[model samples]
Target: MAGFGWATHSAHKHSANRHHLRTKARMDAGFRQMNGNLERKGSLTSSYLEEPLNKTGVVSCIFSLKQEVGALVKALRLFEEKGINLTHIESRPSRNNKEEYEFFISVDQLSSKALDEVVDGLRTQISGQVHELSRNKQKDTVPWFPNDIQDLDRFANQILSYGSELDADHPGFTDPVYRARRKEFADIAYNYRHAQVIPRVEYTAEEKYCGYREDNIPQLEDISHYLQTCTGFRLRPVAGLLSSRDFLAGLAFRVFHSTQYIRHSSKPMYTPEPDICHELLGHVPLFADPSFAQFSQEIGLASLGAPDEFIEKLATVYWFTVEFGLCKEGNEVKAYGAGLLSSFGELQYCLTDKPKLLPFEPEKTCQQKYPITEFQPVYYVAESFEDAKEKVRKFASIIPRPFSVRYNAYTQRIEVLDNTQQLKNLADSISGEISILCTALRKME
Candidate 1:
């Protein structure tokens, strides 16, 4: 695409918000419904094309075409002949001409010279005036982890803006405020539809998870029981405080911390750490799926008796896969990672033009550094849960460990392979307790 010259904008002065309102109102008039907001293009604002593209090496350009039939085919044929790869395609009413429409196209791996050539080719071959209107360059950025207390306020505000609020049906606690907070968390958790990890289950009394606590929020039992029926994992409740290291060790399944430690009482949506919201909403649902449960366990199992370096790698894998991973759901991409699943702002941000999406590769994901203070600049996309599980297993197999582990459902404890006499005795002591066994083994280490 040519420089910024081709971009079109409203001649009248309009603020960014005004432009957005006008554009959104107009765009919605035609399409059935939009999953995401319309990305502004043209001279009125910063052109997306000007932004730096990331490793995905994808660039998008908008061109005008007549509403006449075969016009789109001719335009596509031009790219096919030039061997240009088109990643996405959509159309909008031309700002200059109402009768005609502008086709927005995204292409991969095409440099400035090559893109210019394609634009020139389209202009010469097509009957309509094909102009490269706007382009967006996807830039690579460091992963941002929110570590500040204030960030919670910003996150909560954004989540509320998405119309996610507490409901009466949400989980309740003895503390009225805590009960309301749990309700808000329930609303937040069920805000997004997650079909990939949460499958329907026919629960039996034997299949029900027996870990619900009185302080634990409601709806958790339903979700946890559903998960237990499917993934062989339950949503276990943890009382009071526990360090990050101890939290995962004491439970083979995911654990939800009580609401007493919840951050931001005024805005319960803001969780400084993985409180009830993060655990029950973010982690529990995923654990309900067998494949994801296995993947999670592999990471958990690999952490045992592993070097710090290996542990870090495993954590990175968990971060990408379990916390903020995305997957292809039919034609559109969907969020499955708990981090994205819980926060509306982050979830919507992932689906927006921002953030670099990389194909999930264990080595690359493990090596990639992440930030803890802000919205992630990048996320890994898996083809499916099965694909994610396979890649995770492959990565887990290479982690340096003295012993392998297998989870026995009948005993409900992890069987350590080739354990010493002392280890064997400890395992026998906690015969049916996975978390206690892991905790004992951790203390021994």
Candidate 2:
């Protein structure tokens, strides 16, 4: 709620390696037990939060969403039939509670049998839902049309198109007034390697978002400066991630590449598009964390290689976890999911009872669709950080993992999509360099 004053795991300078020293000592004793690590607020509690515990075999799935009762019930049955255990759930109102939305959900503590069946079954069920679904990640292993490489290139071209369209007036962005603001825009994207956009509005100057955002600051005219001033982010690799964009045209400077965004005190749910206030405070800390930093860099790099569908799916994954995911330790749930951590409302709701919790399975998560407007009806939880990291790591691979597919298409289309141009170009590019790379990479076998 305030500026640069909150404590963070990034500031966790106690030498986590000592954790291993203690772990080895425990191992020499006899049995190795690890209580999941948890550090929650007022009401949250976990055995691990109080002490260290070990797990012989535990699987955690990560997820989030927004929808109604019937939709959730259908999702529930799919997990139920597979013997999957539902562990945690929380919900928030839609953007405006826009659509009679349900709660956000989470599930954890699953068995191998539950893993195999639930994954297989939910993969089938999630796609079947009338909504779009996204799991943390699971590749087809068979080599789909695209990989992370493709997503990188696809967005490159898009940014290029957007960038080229920018008038001399707007160097980094293409909007009218900023048309004259282009040079100022490109400098930040290039210097800080923080080239992202957010729509800038004159009247909402003090509001959280004006569309394109970066570093979570409202009117983030310069991303590089924001990184330096806020969290001391130098963007060595983050800078590299920017140049990888091969798209010829310049991307609109309006794209709000952020570390912070504003939060509405009166609101009750988290919005995926961050305001300057939220981004700077919530995201920058994680970026400063070594594991999280490297992981995000790899993800961005991997995105350069992924396909369109994969990229879109990845966005959902990011939304659910890095942006708005939650985790459970012992019986208490804490906010590890960025969306929850950054959001005041979801910060509370994700740990509360408005939504249903489900065991996280890549297959099922990929098949489930969620609304961005309000609180989620379901959340996928992991017993530990490994549950969260391993899945994301797998997504960067070249092999195909399972993907979500639907048997029926929803007739109610609130959104209009013109797949003609973007898809065609994207499809072509995927089949072009990405397809060849996947094929060659797989040939190593």
Candidate 3:
């Protein structure tokens, strides 16, 4: 994953793990803020210190629904008429959900002032509502069409997820099967693999203090007791694209991110800063389910852009809705964020009186306010995964084929058929010419 370059707002610790923060609206800054300039830490952690972002991109704006929706609708209509291509749409709640909401929108190309004017014109502020501020803002242009064959090549390159239990004996090693699988997949990336987090083991040599005082990676059996008794949420990060938006797009398509790292035995609720363990073990299982995976990909493609402010705001939406989203699951508040996967804190926090849980509303979520230092004060509850997808669809209604699995599958198959048909024609033509030559040669003979 490429590191996100963030422009910092202040030099302060946003979270316990320096990795869990962000700065400013769009500019990702350095690990340590200094001098008027928010130094580029050259890493995602130092940059988006307090601000949560999708993948590693900077997020600048969580636009107010009242302030930007009109503009957004206007922009979408204009895009339709002018053949503009839009990519992403998401919403997050304002930290204070009493009035406004935040909306995050992105397209292949950045939006311009003219476009913003159209969007702003369409924006309608509610009575006594404040428009959200913009930060690290960027407007991208519609992406040029990709070379189909090149894109095909990119798609054809497959990375399969594979791993095994740690060997334990290797000290910093995984199981022998895990070792073997890792070796097999060492060269390939952009893969979807299935791995479990073994809590009773050491993750890396850097942290040699194994919780169990044992010499092994955690296993399913070892953690079964904990899982049976597990409560709350666990956060796992699926790394998004850095530098190349397409890499992030690809992840948005289908590939889920994960790691082989396991947590120490000491912490039953182990949360690594950012690792395959947290990402894969905690998150990919959701991807395995078609509903979650489709929702993820659909939402991913539905929400692509470059403005840092927009990215930051979208991250919050993803965190609150997809990552840490709660839903009415059989008379209970269930989790969706990987962060809540195994964390006791999440289970309690999400259900506690502190959070203002609202029915998932695109407009409200977009205007919602949140802070990096505190546990979320509000979480938008979706009716279902479909409700989440609907939120994306409703936002990007003007954009056609916003993550239609049937369509993606159909197109994917069509491309295959098209390639196959071309080869078949070549083969037949070659054979026909060969036969003609043979006939001519025979006559001469």
lDDT of 2: 0.37
TM-scores of the models, in the order given: 0.44, 0.37, 0.44
lDDT of 2 by residue, 170-218 (tens): 2223344433333333333334422334334243342323323433333
Cα lDDT tens digits, model 3, 128-219, are 22222122322322221111212312222222111222324332253344354444333232332223342232345533343323664444
* lDDT by residue for model 1 (1-445), tens: 0000000111111112111111222311211111012243222111112222234565656667768888888888877777777887877775445557777776775554467667776677774544323234112111111112111111121111111232343222234765444445444433322122322223223212222233434454466567667866654332222222222332332222222123333334443334444565566667766777777666655554444455456656766777788999899899988777767777778888799999999889988876555677899999988887777777767865434555455544444453243356556657758877788999999
- Alpha carbon deviation, residue 207, candidate 3 (Å): 7.8
Give Cα-based local distance difference scores for all models: 0.49, 0.37, 0.40
Q: Give the TM-score of candidate 3.
A: 0.44
Off by over 4 Å in 2: 1-256, 259-273, 395-398, 401-445
Model 3, residue 127: C-alpha shift (Å) = 45
Q: Each candidate: how many clashes?
A: 16, 121, 85
Choose 1 or 2, whichever is better by lDDT: 1
